[model samples]
Target chain A: MNIFNYELKINLKSSLYYLLGMIALTSLYLTFFPSFSKDTSAFINLLEGFPPEFQNAFGIDLKNILSIMGFYAFILFYILLISSIQGMNLGVSILSKEERDKTADFLMTKPVTRSKILISKLGASITIVLITNLLFYLVSYMSINLIIEDTFSFKVFTLLHLSVFLVEMIFLSIGFFIGVFLKKVKSTISISLAVVFSFFAIGAFAVNASDDKMRYLTPFKYFDTNYILKNGTYELSYLVVGIVLIILCLVGSYFIYVNKDIDSV
Target chain B: MASNIIEMKNLTKYYGKARGIIDITFNIKEGEIFGFIGPNGAGKSTTIRTLLNLIHPTSGESTIFGLDTTKYPAKIAEEVGYIPSEIFYYDNMKVKELLKYSASFYKKDSKKRMAELVDIMELDVNRKIRDLSLGNKKKVSIIQGLMHEPRLVILDEPTSGLDPLMQQRFFDLIMEENKKGTTVLFSSHILNEVQKISTRVGIVKEGKLIKLEDMNTLREKTYKRVLIESSTPIDDNYFNIKGTKDFKTVDDKLSFLYSGDINLLTNKLSTLKVHDLLIEDPDLEDIFMHYYVREE
Candidate 1:
């Protein structure tokens, strides 16, 4: 348990700079918007003049263009991008990093089982993902409160943020699974990026193309911001699917990492 | 009592269809320094990997400290310290952090052990492992392997990157560990180092244990280079003596490898009034070459 905490501490310390950088970027984009005032006719006319395909690509509905909820939808893309990057970086590097660094032999030489070592690393990685998402949520919430109108429901806001976290966890676990299959660090990073961005692309295309049934194919589509905003609730089916995928990926990662042949120091 | 600290009974490993190691059998007594000496691609690393359960053997059985390697690898790992040929550490981690993380597995007093090892290996605990030289990284690896005070220590090419001074220090460290009843099994291509430390040595060749014996016995049984100066030119037929190979002939002098009964050759030479005779004991490298050439 102490070892798990130590591992977590090390991960958190290493991730702090990246977390701060993401938050800084998020805050800069949210606070320094080119058009901030809601009553400007110029902004309203510009929104009206945008193509429907462009609006759909950005998850902007026709009715909610001038509303604070719509702005939240625009910022959500950046949030998902940042969260996925963090998740993948943390997840893919956790166990395989030992192998990449040639430190597996040094670690294995100790009086511990492979299962225990793996569990500790997994625990640390999950904690990093959770902490990063939570930090992003908190920063975004504060920014939204200060910059956007008060009409935004805290409950719906929480649901949207929680959905983003779930999607991140799913992607993170997938990255963890990739780490077991890929040994080289560069390959692990490339594969992780490819996987996360590919899912994002699929979900974006499915939503923009108005293919409701196929939206379930991509995890990002599972968190429907407009549905959550309108109904004041998350989709149960999507939540369940996300949870199941996360569990499967995590279990698969553990099985593969434990049995894989590791070169020692 | 545990019969052997380490044992392998006809162990074999295959990487796909290629044999990694084949029919290797040996045992190391408790607290003895056992040397695994071999040339490149001779299966030394494969055999060590099998013993540590890093890779599963295709056939045969291995045990460390009386526990089956495959069946109870975690248990065996708990008692054995392993230093692999190549050492790599997480780039983001400092040396201290790396060592701490490594020591966490053993469920021991890691802090004290880490401090002691840092002092012994003269390592900079604060530097990130990526920034350290290969020798320093090897020192860090040595510290990690020894910190837990395991019952058995297994090192592959343990002194490859170290300077002569550090290598001597490492030898001293191994000696100290052996004195405290820790069994040491090390593989090296450097025959002199093996000869200095190993109570018994196993010579591996082409994935086979070509020779296994006490160091003294191996030294005694190895061939001697015989140089002869004949009163008259010796017959070329004399070169056909058993165990004589790589025979070279000059005007009145002859040179050949001699591994068999020396008395018969000397007696045969005495009839021609031997002018001068010189015999030199073969070193481990010579013995190794002899076996390889003979096999070919």
Candidate 2:
């Protein structure tokens, strides 16, 4: 318990920095877009002026751009983009750093089990991502409340942030899986980026495609920002699927880490 | 009731198809300083890693404190302190921070232990690990390994970066630890250092334990160089003594590598017109080279 807390303490600073940076960037972007905080019709008009292909590529829908929920549609996709990269960097670097630095041998010689060491690292990574997402939520909420004077549903804002949090956790879990399977640090980072981007591309295509079947194929399509904007809620089935995938990925990571041949210092 | 702290029975390790170590078997008694001596790529590190349970053995078994290495690795690790040949710490961590992080694993007064080790090793804890010199970094590694005062200390090439004075100081520390009943297992290619502290020496070559014996016994059994200056050219047949392994004749001098009783060498020399004879006792280097060359 003390060791785990010690590990957490060491990582807390980096986690806070990442969180604060994300919040700062998001706030700056929101503050710059004056139309987004002012007239909803102007925001909708601005989104509609873009080419349909461009809007689809960015996972933005012009139809719901005027609604209170439409703001969430824009924010969710952007949050996923930032959070996935952050999560992947944190996960892929954790264990591989020990090997890259030639400290695995020394750490392995301690009385702790492999599982225990991994658990502590995993716990730290998760805690960091969660704290970052929480800060993002708080910052986004305050920005929306302070900047937008018009009446907007607070429930939509809550649901949007909650869905984003779930998506971030899923990416974090996938990143953990990547870390366990890859040996070299460079390869791990590269593979994690490829996997995350591929998923994002698949999700974008699924959202834009005319075929209804394509929607089920991508996790991103499940949390349709357009649907969330119109209904003020996330799709329950998609939420369940995302939760299941996260659990499976986490379990797979543990299995790989437990049996894999760990190199010494 | 043998006080064996470690025992290996025909242990072997393979990295894919390449053999890392083959059929290595040895035992180290409690409080003994056992030196694992070998040349580069001789599988010294492989055997040490296997004993520490850092890598799994391909065959046979190893037990530390009578507990199976694989089955009870955590238990064994709790009592064992390990110093790797190449010591590396996180780049951004201060020396003091790294020590504190490592010390957190053991149930001990980490701060007090850290202070004592810092004093003994004469290391600056405030400096970032990346900023330290190779010798200073190595000192930090040594301090981390010994701070917990484990029952068994496993150090691979522990004094590689230390200067002669520091090496002597390290020897003194090891001797002092041994006096307090700590079993030290150190591997090194430097034969002289191994000979200075080791009670028993295990010579590894080509992934095998070619020689394991008491340090004194190995010293006694190793081939002695006999350089003889003869009044008359001695016949090549005179060099074919029973214990001699290799014989070389140069001008008036005949040199024979004697692996047997010195008495037999003396008798052989008595038969020749030996004006002057020099018998050089084999040091660890000679013993290591003899076996390594013979194996090759």
lDDT, residue B130, model 1 = 82
Residue B231 displacement in candidate 1 (angstroms): 18
Write out the backbone clash pairs for model 2: A105-A265
TM-score of chain A of each: 0.88, 0.87
In order, the TM-score of chain B in each prediction is: 0.80, 0.80
lDDT of 1: 0.78
Off by over 4 Å in 2: A32-46, A187-191, A212-218, B110-113, B224-244, B248-296
DockQ of each: 0.49, 0.55
Native interface contacts kept by each candidate, as a fraction: 0.61, 0.73
**B27-46: candidate 1 lDDT, tens digit per residue:** 88898899999887889998
Q: Per-residue lDDT tens digits of candidate 2, residues B13-112?
A: 9999987999998899999999998877889999988887778899999999999998888888877888888888777889988888888788766677
